[model samples]
Target: MSFSRIAFTVTAFFLTTSALTHAEEGKFTASPGLQLYSLRSQFKLKGVSRTLDTVKSFGIQLVELAGTHEMPIPEFKKELESRGLKAVSAHYPYKRWQTEPDAVAQEAKELGLEYAGCAWADHKSPMDEAQAREIAATFNQAGAALAKVGIKFFYHLHGFEYQPWKKGETLADLIIQETNPEQVKFQMDTLWVVFPGQDPVKLLEKYPNRWDLMHLKDLKQGVATGSLSGQTDVNNDVTLGTGQMNWAAILATAQKVGVKYYFIEDESSSSESQIPKSVKFLQSIRW
Candidate 1:
C-alpha cells in the first residue's frame, strides 16, 4: 500500500472510533464537580485535609473554592494535586478584589486555576443605581487586573440582584451593562437565581456571552422567592434532580450560552448524602 493510503486508513479508523464514543454519550453529559464551600463548616472544624478527602471520595476532581481555610496558596495547590483534584475557579472576598486584585490574580495563577472571581458584593437591599455602578466599577478594576495576569475574573450572582431596581430592569441589568464583557464574566448560581424567583434559562438567553460558569445548585420545592435578602436557609438546598430547577432546559441553554464549568454547591446539612446523588443525576440527564 502507498504511504498516503496507509495514513488515510489509520485516520479514518480513529475518526470512526471517536464518533462512536461521542454517539454513546450525547453532547450534554454533566461532569462531576464540587464547590469546596459546600463543606465550609466541616473544613473550619476538621481542617482542609478532611474536607478534601471527602471531596475526592465523591469523585469530584474539579472544584470552585471559597477560601483556603488559612492554608498557604502553594500548600493548598499541592494538596489539591496530591488528591487528584483540580481547581477550576476560586472565589475571593469582594474586598480582596477591591484592594489587592493583582495579588489575587497572581495567586490564582500559582494555584494553576483557570479563573478567579467573587461570590458576593457588598450592596444594600433594593440596590440603587449608585451601588450597582459602584460594584460594576469594582468588577471592572478586578476583571481588568486579572486579565492582565492571564486569569479570567467572574462575578457570582446572589439572589438579590434579581429584584427590580428600575422600570423593568434589575440591578443585575446594571452590572451586565456597566462592566465590560471582555474583562468580566458571570457564574449563575442556580439556587440563588431560583431563590429570587428568577429563571436561569431566561438569564442565559438574555446575555449569552456574559456568563461563563455555573454553580449547579438546586432548591427545595415550595420555597418562597422574589427575595432581595441575599441570605437563605441552608436547608433549602436539595439534590439536583429533586429540586425546583429544570436541569434539562437549564443545561441545554447553558451549553448554548458557552458556560464552561459547572460546580455542584450543596449548602445543606445533608451534602454528604446529596453530592453523590447530584453527580448521578447529572450523569443520567439526557439532552
Candidate 2:
C-alpha cells in the first residue's frame, strides 16, 4: 500500500477506537436498587413477596434494606431470591449495632449485604474544632468495630455534617480523613449534598474512592436545609430524570469514582406511582 494511504487508514482506526472508548466510558445504568423505605407503604399493602415482584417488574435487580420489615432472616432471603433481586447494602441504627455488633453482623450475613450502613448521628451541634476531631475518632472506632467482623460499614452523610469546624475544613472532610477507607466508606446522597450548599460533583472529586454507594434523591424548591432534621413532604419525590439534580453530571462522576450502588430513594407519598416511573427513567438512562 502507498505510505499516504496507510497513514489515512491508521488515523481512521484511531478515531474510531477513541470514539468507542468514550461511549463505553460514558455509559451508565440505574442498577442500584431501592431503599424499600421509598415504597414502605406499597410494600405493606402488597406484602413482601408481592412487593419484591412489583420491584422486579420495574426492572430493579438490587435493593438496600430499611429494616427487614420484621421478617425472619431466612424468609427475607427467600423473598429476595424469589424475585431475582439481591441486597447490596442495608441501613440499621448505629446505636443498636454499637451494642450488638456480632448480632448485627449475623443479620447482615443472612441478608447477603456488602455494606452495613448508619444514617444520621449527632456529634454535637455547632461543633468546635476539638469536638470535630472527637467526632472523627468516634467514627473511626465504629468503623473498626464493624470491620472486625468482615462487614463493611458506611457513613451516610446528612446535611447537618456540612458545617465548617475549622479553617478550610468541613465536618464531612474530617470524617473522611479520620475513618480508614478500608473500614468505612461514604454513601453520598445527592439531595443532601446539594441542599447544604455543597456540590456533589466536587465532593466526589474531593474524595477518591471514598464513596461506594449513593442515594439518588432530590430536594424540592422550598425544602429545609440538607440536615435530616428538616422535613419535606414525601409526596414530592419525583422520577429520577425529572428532579432538580443534574443527574447526568452526577452519574458521570459517580461512574468515574466506581460507585457501585445507586438507590432510588423516593421518600414521597406517590411512591407506588413514582417507583415505576423512576425505574423507567433509570432504565432509559444510557449510563
Candidate 3:
C-alpha cells in the first residue's frame, strides 16, 4: 500500500474510536433527572407553564412528579411531553393509596409513569412498630394492585422510621422485613437518611436490590442530626457537592446495589439557583 494511503486509514480508525469512546462516556456521565417538587414554590408563584419552562432551561429531560399543580392529568402529561420531559415516577398521598389505590394506578397510567410512591407514611410521631407494620400492609396492598397495571410501587423513607426497635433494629427494618419485596420497593432520600443520622452507604449494602430509586439531595454541613421527627427546615437543603454528603461513596454503593433511577431534589427556596450547580456537580463525578 502507498504510505499516504496507510496514514489516512490509520487516522480514520483512531478518529472513529475516539468518537465512540466519548459517546459512551457522555452516556455514563450524564446527570440524573430533577424532581419537580424541587420547584414547588415556583409552580405556585409563577404558574405551571412558566415553572416548567425554567426546568427545561436547565437542560433536564426527565423528571419525577409530586403532583400536577391541579392541572387535569392528561393536560399535565401533555405539557411534559411537549417539553421533551418524561415522568418516570410520581408521589401520591398515603391516604389516596390506602383508600383508592386503583384510582392512583389509573392516574399513574395516565401520566405514563413507571413507578408510583408515597413520600411519607403518615404515622404518629416517633413512629412505632405497630405503625410501621400498618404502613407495610398498606404498601403491600397498594404495590400489588399497582403491579397488575404495570406500575411499580415504592416508599420514600422520611427519617422517622429510624426509631429504635428491639434487638438494635429500627422500625424501618421491621417495615422492610414485613413487606413483600416482589411488590414493594424503596427510594432513599439522601437528606432524610443523613438527617436521621443513618449511613446511606451502609443501608445500601444492607438492603441490596430493594432500593430501586434515589433522591440525590444533600444536607447542610454542621447541622444537628439524630432526630426522629422526620422534619427539618427546607433551607437545610444545599447544592449537591456543597453539602455534608460523601457523594462518591454513596453513589458508588447505590450503583453497586442496582438502584435504577436518581433525581436531584432540592427543596430549598434557593432551588432555582442551586439546581444547575447540582447538575454540574453530578456531571463532574467520574465513578
Better of 2 and 3 by lDDT: 3
lDDT of 2 at 11: 100
Badly placed stretches (over 4 Å) of model 1 are 1-27
Write the residue-wise lDDT of candidate 2 on 6-121 in tens digits: 99999999999999987775546546688888878877887788788878887788899888777888889888988888898888786655566667777787787888888766
Q: Name model 2 segments beyond 4 Å from true.
A: 1-25, 123-135, 221-230
What TM-score does candidate 2 reach? 0.85
Summarize candidate 3's per-residue lDDT along 1-287 as a digit string, tens digits: 99999999999999999998876542224359999999999999999899999999998998999999999988998888889899999999999989999999989988899999999989878788889999999999999889989999999999999999989889999988899998899999999999999999999999997999999999998999999898999999999988899998898888778889999999999999999999888878754
Instruction: Give the candidate order by descending lDDT.
Output: 3, 1, 2
Q: Against the unseen true structure, what C-alpha lDDT does each candidate score? A: 0.88, 0.77, 0.91
Clashes of each: 0, 6, 0
Q: What is the C-alpha local distance difference test score of candidate 1?
A: 0.88
TM-score of each: 0.88, 0.85, 0.89
Which regions in candidate 3 have their CA more than 4 angstroms from the true location?
A: 1-30
lDDT of 1 by residue, 170-274 (tens): 989999889989989999999888888888999999999999899988889888877778888998899998988888889989988788899999999988789
RMSD of 2: 3.8
